[model samples]
Target: MSNRNIKVVRVTKDDYDQVCAITPPGQIYSGTDYLPDYFHMLLDMSNVEAYAAVVDGKFASFFLSFVVDNGRTVVTRAGRTNKEYAGMGLQDVMRRNTIKDRKYDKMAATSGAHVKAILDQIKSGKREKILMMEFRSYITSGDQLKSILNTIGNTTPSSAKPIDAIELGDILTNQQVSCHLFPESRVIVDWVPYRLIKSNAFLIKTIRTTVIGSNLENGTRILTFGNYFNTTAGLVCNIEVYGCIGETLAEHLYLHLRELISHEISGKVIIRCFYRQETKSNFITKLMNRFGLDITEIWGTGLVCTETTPEIYFR
Candidate 1:
């Protein structure tokens, strides 16, 4: 291990093939997983920086930093190490090196397996500095998609409207939205963290995400954002649900799924719905059980290390 020199560098177009070649964990998610399909777009995304962990000369791992929440927050995610170098400390080195010089009020990471490590850091000191939030996702195919939508057909809010760039900006900037819809003023669409600001609106649009909302009196009561992309398994549609449960959640879920039919998109489509921790368990049970549709789930933890979080500190 001492002889191996690991260098972390900014990802470039030249690293595309190598980064894609790095073998991802063989563990299958109920959903599709691939690196290459998304790397190309990340290179040109606004305020997003992607890094590669190179062992000697090969791209052995990758990390991404998203500067959002009006530049006060840094969202770090998509960290991966090749199977060949799994046990080595390349990930720690990459985390430490990539954060140098960049300043932020806090750094947040979404983890499926490393949540406990982040929790350990929080336990070492005051817990308020380091915060934890849980999110869950369920992935289903086009057949299930059709079944659920058909079963729950005509049951969604008639007012759920797909907002354009301008309206999306308005919703994100609303104080009520920050407090209720998105906790801690952090807005994550699909799996990426993004600010709710109007300017940040175009960023999600670049990825072709559509924002839909209902019950917008003082603030939105139910909101959902999503987009789809090609993957090794087929086309994957990703949705993030916030501030709604029961029939309302189902309504938004229906709206998102209707995209395939409305657009006349035909293929083997995989739908992955990401929802907040607060969503009631019965909602999911009913959504599937009542309709006899099955949904495969994955759990994730959101570690928000605030500016004052000392033990879990980064930079």
Candidate 2:
């Protein structure tokens, strides 16, 4: 039975303003929402599909699905709705319609309270937990960076440097980097998870991110993928870290922080870090103890703190 009040339809560039304008609450994934920036790019792709729930002749919610990992999975993102239509169930209606059209397995990446909602949905239906990672968001400023700068104390930065597309693709494929750094051979980029494959690495290049990591050599571990975007909350410094936990990981984090400081990133900086669960305590511990600051601080409000991002499969 079709509901006369609402209908799900594929979106296009013409729907950009309607979709991007709907700031329901919190954010889509994390950091600055790439939805507004990359929506057109997604629409241009033949394999990608973005759908919106038009309720009573108005765009109510938006969702995007992109095939990845040799078409084995469809990553669903850019999920949100208008606060005006909050209890209307537009998001669910749009998501269900979109999933029904997808032939491959589906994945939903969410955090904090949204993660629980996704998990709850999975329990009721057919969904699998692909991966789980911890996210720490800290509001920092230049003054704060100064306070922590002294704690590092004559520490030289690691060999971590910016790599081009080719180099990044190569580094991600390194056996050690893929096995140890990446959990289940999945690389988390800007909070979106992708398999440990060169193709995905190259795909990220379109996002124009700086892949910072060193060449692995005998137990060596280092990987930092970071990119910042303009937001009302100030410059959002979004990043993901994949490295050996504890001291080594802390050092790698500092390397990114130190590099960030040099750019003199203006305004309140929301430094969001995504890392594995087992390493969070020790990693943040050493980071604070060594650098006098950490992203482990509780997010007061405004943004939803997605504790675990689980990818639910439709197939």
Whole-model lDDT values for every prediction: 0.63, 0.63
Deviation of model 1 at 279, angstroms: 2.8
Model 1 worst lDDT window (10 residues): 302-311
- TM-score of candidate 2 against the unseen true structure: 0.75
Clashing pairs in 2: 111-306, 112-306, 112-307
Badly placed stretches (over 4 Å) of model 1 are: 25-31, 125-140, 143-157, 194-196, 218-220, 230-235, 260-270, 288-292, 298-315
Q: For residues 192-305, what per-residue lDDT tens digits would candidate 2 score against the true structure? A: 567767777666655536667654554666677776665555556666767654455655666666756766566666677666766545556446445544454544212121
Candidate 2 backbone overlaps, count:
3
The positional error of residue 119 in candidate 2, measured at the CA in angstroms, is 2.7
List residue ranges in candidate 2 displaced over 4 A. 1-5, 24-47, 83-89, 96-102, 142-158, 174-176, 246-251, 254-266, 280-282, 285-315
Per-residue lDDT of model 1, residues 1-315, tens digit only = 678987778888788777767764234233355455566777777777888888988888887777766777666756777888888877667666656666676666544434566556556642333333444344455665677667666664677878787887887788766567777666667555665677877766655577888786644387778787666555667776777554666666566667754543444565555566565655665664443334544434332443332135632
Question: Where is the poorest 10-residue window by lDDT in model 2?
Answer: 300-309
